[model samples]
Target: MITERKIDLTGLKCPMPIVQLAKLIKELDAGEEFTATADDPAFCLDVESWCNKTGHELIRLEDSNERLVAVIRKKISEVE
Candidate 1:
């Protein structure tokens, strides 16, 4: 079974949101998906770059209300 996780980092400044998101991603099992919300203007770019660099899949990312919402899927292997 797959479990969904959530990380809300709204109102946080740059880097903190991405830092926390990365930490949460590390704790998840392969195939697990998580939803993260952040209001930092740089979150969208930071997250996209991070995911691309780390191999995690960015399932969805969008702006809603005053926040940036992201849905990410953990990669099965770190080296893959």
Candidate 2:
């Protein structure tokens, strides 16, 4: 079964949200998903770029209330 984790990054500044996201992604198994909520205005763009650069999938991104919410799926492990 696929697992989904939730992370709250509200009030965090630029980079911190992405930093926390990266840390959480590292701990997730391949194909697992995470939903992160942040108040940083840059989070929307940052997460998109991060996913593109890292091969992860940005499944959904939206603004709710005063927060930016993103759902990301962990990338499959690369063969060595």
**Candidate 2 residue-wise lDDT, 15-76, digit = tens:** 78888988888889998988998988888889999998888999999987768989999888
Backbone steric clashes in candidate 1, count: 0
Across residues 1-80, which tens digit of lDDT does each residue of candidate 1 receive?
Answer: 77778999988998788789778887899989999989888898988999998899999999877689999999988793
Misplaced by over 4 Å in model 1 are: none
Locate the minimum summed-lDDT window of 10 residues in model 2.
71-80
| Each model's lDDT | 0.88, 0.88
lDDT of 1: 0.88
How displaced is residue 19 in candidate 1, in Å?
A: 0.9
